[model samples]
Target: VFVCKKFLKKDGRKVRKAAKNEIMILKLVSHPNILQLIDTFETRKEYFIVQELATGGDVFDWILDQGNYTERDASNVIRQVLEAVAYLHSLNIVHRNLKLENLMYYTENNHNKVVLRDFYLSRFENGPITEPCGTPEYLAPEVVARHRYGRPVDCWAVGVIMYILLSGNPPFYDETEEENTDLHNRIIFCRIVAGDFEFDSPYWDDISPAAKELVCRLMEVDQMLRITAQDALYHEWIAGNGASEKNLKDGVCAQFEKNFAKAKWRVCIHSCSVNVRLNEVGNNSSRGILEEKPDEDQGLNVLLARNTTQQRYGPLKLFPSSVPAHCHSACPRRDPSTLPHFLSLDYTQMFKVACSTPFLLLICTSL
Candidate 1:
């Protein structure tokens, strides 16, 4: 449990509002790598957020205890952190205050899992965010410039975290406080370019090139060019062949299916071969309206169509060439009652609909 405003602020109203936002965001997000928010409460003087206690403590403390972590250990931790970030971005949330001090570890049934804690600086995508926050060491250039930013700022912090995990020190540092402040200013101005920073330590010698590439991409100054969370998931280091190929294939297939299921449809047509039924028109009239029953063989196809397009057409196919060309031409002009009973029309006039529309083309493209 962490309480706000014991030493930081004196106002209880502000603390309560902040705590409420934190709870709302936490309650909406659920990921294996993110720390679970248990509950929240308010007191006369302070507000408190109850979270799952991390037995392994903060990553900073854990690293300090080990003196330094091996590349394998660092990679495992970083991968989990990226997974958490991916989940956050999926919900359009950005963990703007990410740092080693905020990462926690837990042991359940003798198995360990990293958990991301702290959300004081988190923000919804494009949300009104001001007040330059987060530690200086992990702050992005844009952030230091006090410019408005989105989730990519979190990727910059992830880069800093990666550097710290791999080298046991930040990529940029100075011998004195004054020099450090100067370097920080240079970083904010984009003068201290990331590409110019080289890793010369013995620890980096054994590190894979893919890991280095990913870190560099994540730390890019241009947020537009920075690797997105989804793209990072497909990076060479993260999607390495260590995992079973079958599992990866199945996972990709499942994701495709999930995306396909959400598409909308504009049209559906069905045809049937059953004997046509007719209804009498009037007391003196013998003409009848024709209707055909749906066929069972088309079950799987119908289900697939439904899954692919929100609009469903049953049993019908476009007029076959077997029908005379004249009949095909005249069919469009015929009345519904006189037209072929086997044919059912359920299709959009346009071949392709706009992406914003609820149509089959968008769904097919998504799949």
Candidate 2:
């Protein structure tokens, strides 16, 4: 079955514009690692776009099911993403949002290719883009600083993705951001603008040096020095034998669950209904949240992955909205230990688990 998305015209001028732009981008590109568009329809009040569906689920769920995961595996995943980004770069397009939530698997097999999704925020870079939009932790230094930027931002996001894939922790998070959010957001921005992040001891101990070097280059404070997606494809960590074979499943997964499972700052603060979706849970179906009510007649609206799994989805934001990076976090200069230890919030006001949805209905309205 194909997935159909309904974009309401009344959502406002910006949303309407974004929906049209997304449709154009989806129609312009086709790669084995990117979602494919099938058809489109426009009504007087809404636009309906249909696309191929993924039954496998997303990268997060795939990671949870793996008994053995290594730096090499992470490298392979990153390489595919870079290849896709390189292809897009050749076309002068930029996927502004490139977080873990956007990567999915193609099937339920033991081995599958990862695919990239959610291009509503992606844009064709005709010139320097000045808008600061995207997930906070993944925003490039130039974007955080409100400076002109373009495609390197995606490479920077790839660096953030690689960091989480290897360590299970966000490179730029401040444990204390939960208490004083606005102040912390200011602090996080300052740190990001300064290119202040670290490969802390225990986490980086087993990680390969070449991999670390690549992360640094991708997240270079100066966008001018940042590695392009095409160049990054040749990095030793991605091309050579720089990734370690040591199984990092326990440590990395524990951190992944710890970091992503927390109720996000906006989720906790916003007084809105969150459509929570669980990926690949016991069926060839995808799981996700949407603002719309569950209606059997509605059919499928969004497809997360092609992998079928009994394990459920990865961090539940694969079809997340374009969140402008105004999040809070602690200053990076403070000793990580000194920040108040953050407690994981069980899915309460913001999150709900899905039971059985053949396809994810992920429609979020930004507040």
Candidate 3:
């Protein structure tokens, strides 16, 4: 897609390095589960990054519509994600941001297969990354603390995704901004640092012990102690040798419906701040965040804009909108932590998510 270079020009050095790093890394890797960067274009005003399109909606939306899934289904999905991560770590490439939104189906007809996309925050692990990038909910403890980190952070995010896939809820969350802000901080200090979480009853009662154990090991607070993606692939749950557990499809589906109701409301404040400006920005430019003109593909209305943002901003805002560096544009950078954490989703609020059309537009311009 066409990308504006306004923001990249502002933070020339680091943003360029990050973008180049992502491009180089993506170019080297070829996996069914990882996105392929087909081509690129550079012009005076914009740069175009051409990636394979994912026609089926995101995993979360797919699951919600499917109503429910089985452990086999979760295992199949996680296995693909883990295999992709294992390949990246073997090359010392770390995908710091692995979330539900980043995983998508390759085609509308194939919901069973998923490919991980959006490599904007990825880096090679020659040295530890200390930039504090990635979404808060999936961030590793060391990352949240601003400590040097490596490939294990990706493993931690996998654990979070696995937890949600199994039980249909996040391991750690709060209902309000005050509570979430407080919880977010505590996660950095105590909960995450200490590797603390529980498999509370009912929701997880039917889940296999093997599944829970795998998550516990992967989400270990001590990076040194955490399970690597390669090792996790051999785990009984993922390996498919674990004893059969009760059917969780009905329960999991019920929970997803419940969470989907709250999911839109619980979008990280940081993402919204970066996303909400897309509508205004799109209107201002003929080919802005969302392309008003119809594309050749009739199935997908808007181009899939992809990004994962930290809940708070500092030096990191330099790469706002998470588009490739060449596609950067002007936007007001602000700390959204001061605003209300939760926005209750309703019909009126439909405009909020819809207006932010390029699901990947990470810019939060002050409009």
Q: Which residue runs does candidate 3 get wrong by more than 4 Å?
A: 1-12, 175-190, 243-245, 260-367
Tens-digit lDDT string for candidate 3 (70-151):
7877888899999999998988899887887678777778887898987767878888675566655677877655467899
How well does candidate 1 score on lDDT at residue 340? 39
Q: Candidate 2, after superposition: displacement of residue 28 in Å? A: 0.6
Stronger candidate by TM-score (2 vs 3): 2
1-367 in candidate 2: lDDT tens per residue?
3444656666556556767888899999999888898766666766655566554666766776789999999999999999999999999999997888777676656355888887777889999986656665687877655468999999999999999899988888766745343343445555676678899878888999999999999988888889999999988899999989999998888887666652111121121112322111112121121123343222211212212211112211222233311111100122224523212223221122111111122211111
lDDT of each: 0.50, 0.64, 0.61
Worst 10 residues of 3 by lDDT: 295-304
Better of 1 and 2 by lDDT: 2
Off by over 4 Å in 1: 1-14, 60-69, 108-111, 127-130, 177-196, 241-367
Per residue, candidate 1 scores C-alpha lDDT tens digits across 1-367 of 2211111124333334545667679889888898776555444543444455444555544544443345566667878888999899989998777876567777423224888876755767867443344544566655544456788888888887887666555565533434333333334223223333566555366566777888889889887799987787787777774321111222222322332222212123222222211111111122221123243321111111233333221211111222111110000112235523213322221111211222111111110
**Quality of model 2 by C-alpha lDDT:** 0.64
How many clashes in each structure? 11, 20, 9
Candidate 2 residue 2 C-alpha distance from true site, Å = 2.5
